[model samples]
Target: MTIKSFSFSQLADMRIEGVGIHASYSIDIVIKDENSSSGKNVYISATGKSNAARAAGTGSLLFWCKVRDLLSNKIYSLERKKGEGFAVGFDDFVIGSIMFHIPYNSSSAPKIELEAGYLYDAGYAGTVIPFPRSLKRVIALTQFNRR
Candidate 1:
């Protein structure tokens, strides 16, 4: 499987409900492997940092890294702060983390897109950093794929 990413900006327009908003973006991905089987395990990982800070009352903005499977049309997502939560502050950036798993596959390279957003008071504001366009870098890993 090959992984790549780019930068995104569409997210800058989103807002939570009452909290502030700050986020970054990356590009999509496409995983292709001939060893794909019925129970092969596939794993994808992504990360980003805040480029700017949102307005006030925005609480601590939240960011997330997501992976989308074009073939299955299913998505596995991860957040920056799993349970610890976020605080409202500028220059206080938190790292987002996400881990996902797929049952298995046969012979298809599922298209993947890496998305991120900032959790604000208005709503989620972010975008799916397009591949070879917006993202700067991206990576993909198959934790364990048994035949």
Candidate 2:
């Protein structure tokens, strides 16, 4: 099996503050081939501060990261679960980070787009920071031998 990898770094810091919550962070996304499978794996890691003040109420605060297959227009949203590598700190008011992974089949086309940001209360209010236009990556996948 052959493996290919791609990495992306944010061009600018992403910041969103509202309803007593605020998040400021930088993101890094990596796409690589799975060692034992034909599919690819997406890894996202965001580092900085994601916090909700005591007055922000008891609603859940989530970090949102998504990837779009430009060829198929399929969007994959990263899940927020501890077992999936999603972990962020709130109310601490200190710099921190979060990460998650998504597995997907290789795209027919060579390019993909990514967007990252934060969401509060499952859509109450959120911000999306898209990858820079120039950063849309063109990836070359290794052709697999068919039995």
Candidate 3:
């Protein structure tokens, strides 16, 4: 089991117009089986506090993954939110760990470099002025590559 989070204080010009959100998030990934050996069952989950301080009280939590050795380049993206079912375009997910069947090869566990972020939007004007400045924090969930 492992835990990771990214939090910033003293907003460096960070602001949202009507609805802004602040949160403390955590993630967990674990190997759930030791029998067959391809990719064991992996559980991932995130929880946090979100508040719309500036705009209307409307926003949603989101998650995405791009596993390439578990380390992904840092790129600030609004396209990701609209591109991948998020904000008004996406649906909701359960709070606990979501199970996944991870496959392994070469007698070693599979390693995935994941880069992700969370946001609080004003429904329509996402990452736009009048909306709070969005932040894309790099989350490096390490130690999955070893053992």
| Best TM-score among the predictions, by candidate number | 1
Stretches of model 2 off by over 4 angstroms after superposition: 1-22, 34-60, 81-109, 120-147
Residues 48-144, model 2: lDDT tens digits: 2234322344444444556665555766665454223323444321112333222333534234566555334523464333223123344454432
In Å, residue 21's CA in model 3 sits off its true spot by 11
Winner by lDDT between candidate 2 and candidate 1 = 1
Ranking by lDDT: 1, 2, 3
Clash number for candidate 2: 0
lDDT of each: 0.42, 0.40, 0.35
lDDT (Cα) of model 1: 0.42
Candidate 3 clash figure, as a count:
16
Better of 2 and 3 by lDDT: 2
Error of 3 at 135 (Å): 9.1
Candidate 3 has an lDDT of 0.35
Query: What stretches of model 1 exceed 4 Å from their correct place?
Result: 1-5, 14-41, 51-58, 81-108, 121-147
